[model samples]
Target: MKYSSILFAAALVFLAAGAAAAKVPAGLDRIEHIVVIYLENRSFDNLYALFPGADGPSARTRWAPQQDRTGKVYDLLPPVPDQRFPAALINAPFLIDQYVPQDAKTPDLVHRFYQNQLQINGGRNDRFAAWSDAGGLVMGFYDGRTTKLWAYAKKYTLADHFFQGAFGGSFLNHFWLVCACTPKYDDAPEAIRAKLDDQGQLISDGAITPDGFAVNTIQSRFQPHAASVTDEARLLPPVDLPTIGDSLSDKGISWAWYSGGWDDALAGKPAPSFQFHHQPFAYFSRYGDGSDERRLHLKDEAELYAAIAANRLPAVSFYKPLGIENQHPGYANITNGDNRAADLIDKIMQSRSWKSTLVIVTYDENGGFWDHVPPPKGDRWGPGTRVPALFISPFARKGYVDHTPYDTTSILKLIELRFKLKPLGSRDARAKAPLGALMLESK
Candidate 1:
């Protein structure tokens, strides 16, 4: 059965019409394909406050709601307690050791790992530089459904509201986006030391065990990418549950991943490429076919830019840049990496395949940025974090801003519904379908 499935998929690719990639097929469940464009940091108030244009469902682009119905802006009482404004708290398991604000660079896990810790070297840490004064580190970012890349809001849709699922660092947020699940949200240490890929190689077994791989079964596959690089790995759940790639295969849909560098395929946690889900680690192991047929691993990040114009795009696509450009703490420039990422999405939008697809733009987490709305922890889909989310489609409502609460899981839920595939598990089956607001009635 699996062999026939493979043959069926190959047949579809051979016969897929080039020009047909631009239109959403009739009776296609919901969105036929989705592209998740997750960014680094920043929130809704910071980006949209100065953005002079059409916004929100109400068609107003005014600053935050710290105002009265009578045009009076009021300061929040008991004011939002955010560390990014005045000072951040140094929690335990942070900064290794703390030195009272010295002019020397030492190992500080709190400053590097904690999102709320805004200890910049050689300088002043302005709230505007880290986040906006309107809302503290928790303020979710709102995106212009239009003009993400010089495009018009009337032409696309903006999330206007989104938040991360966790309170710590980048690794956990990135993990959630991929798996729709994770066991350790912020349980791992800041300065993680691993027997696997942290500085070595990962060990794996077929079971979905938490520590990534069973220590006993971790034999050297000898292939450079064979094992993981982190021993501090957390187990991701619902293993048998279908991933997005699994659904694409069931529908005979094709997909591709163009990653940044050596660890571009999301390996090396406790290290740089910490964001990806755990499954990819086992997907193309040298223990299998030993052929790099499934994904495109690039040492050069620029190589992916050209695929934006390719006509035979897989039904689903995910791209993550490499190194300092991806906004790692070691080389962060605080320029709002999303601005550059937004530019990339803009480039992809002008392609020949814009009309038939949906692109979800959001952040993995706040990167210690702020949003006033505390993350909602409903019995199911979330307690989701708040970050700005953007939904872009040709059929998307112009100047629309959905007030509905959404998070990373909403994206997966939308895809599962639209594709008519089985949900990933309990999390997706019952999670709210926020994407329903983005689709046109005719669609």
Candidate 2:
């Protein structure tokens, strides 16, 4: 009895001591600045699955039966259909064989749909009859993968178990990432309201139409802007409901968003938010106001040093990339390993800003990739399907691989918790709380 009692006491002491040794991650400090650089779609393993045992607790998890079986749209197949891909290296059957996955390792319609994103990746392959393995595993035609992100993983913190909120495609998931909720599908106005039911839940369904908000409407708009301003014309309506932007602004902290230029066409994805950040960046460029709320812009990471050297660092700054760096498979740079996304993140870490700054790096969605987790929330869009979340700052614990399930709202939640600020909206306010492991008790 005495020995067991002694062991328990020792364990408690060790636990307390370990917690004392760890410091809070920089993002959760007074956390003056917050910058989220969302990359294109990708899951942790698909990108880092090859991380050579770098896979986390959830890596082994794969697709299987779930209540999600109700979402199958393949049953409504038409006799003839559009070409499966804008460009594919193999015939539909073979392409599906290579990419579209099946349950129990068999050949069937279900497997094909699961393999290449049938509904979300939309298209019919009734005509093209040829199988070519020129490209690689995924369709023979789409050949793009990069080594940059892996290199970045070597340098910074990588959150392996982070997840996307729910199922479906990028549209609703990205909306939730930004606003924490998709306002009743396609509610036209694209607004977020404050309301809670008995559940105190904020996430809603992806029902956009003339009656529901279509995926394109939410996914494309980059500017709270209009066509007259720059490229792709469709602008994301300005969100007044608080975001990480409002959180930092409230603390008299400075923040900036740096984006690679996109005129307008691609506003829905990473493009729109980049422009919104630039609106503030334009303010600092013209007025040269270096006080609180100073925002700036740059097309690439090359200019970051001068800005940091000039001591023009904002409390939080977001770096958006263009061209080869964005990591879109469409960019066709992946296999060749030109991870402009990974390198830019590495570059930011090399800066003096990294010391006190908490860099929140993640992707907008899985970008038609596959992950094993059945997302924990709504059926609309979600927690972007388990991409990696990297935290690189003085406060970040080295070699810390956390398995905590976090989503976009966790970003807002942590900031609000750290600063004693109000939650951004219903989803974040009511969603499950973020793991407090990143935080250290203030002295």
Best candidate (score: lDDT): 2
Tens digit per residue, CA lDDT, model 1, 1-443: 00113322432343342112112334444445566665554444434433444232222422233232233443431122333233433210112113212112111121112213221111121221232232322322333223333243335665655555433344444444544443322233323322233422223222222233111112112222334543523332222323556555667766555555534332433235433332232322321224453333322235446666774455666655543344433344223344556666667678776667677666555544333444554422233335566677765666676667666666666665665555544444455656544655675
Clash counts for all predictions: 42, 43
Structural similarity to truth (TM-score) of each candidate:
0.57, 0.58
On a 0 to 1 TM-score scale, where does candidate 2 land against the true structure? 0.58
lDDT tens readout by residue for model 2, 1-443: 00113322443354344321123344456445555676655556456654533552242543331112234332222221224323333221122323422111211111111222222222221111111111212212121123545544555456776775433344444445544544333234434222223443323322232233333323223223344545332323333333455555656665555556543412334443343322322212121223333323322344454566665666656665653444444443343223555555556566666555666777655544444443444323434356767775555545556556677677756655655655545446545444432443341
Instruction: Give lDDT per model, in order.
Output: 0.42, 0.43
Least accurate stretch of 10 residues (summed lDDT) in model 1? Answer: 91-100
lDDT of 2 at 193: 25
Model 1: C-alpha RMSD to truth? 13.2
**Candidate 1 overall lDDT versus native:** 0.42
Model 2 per-residue lDDT at 253: 61
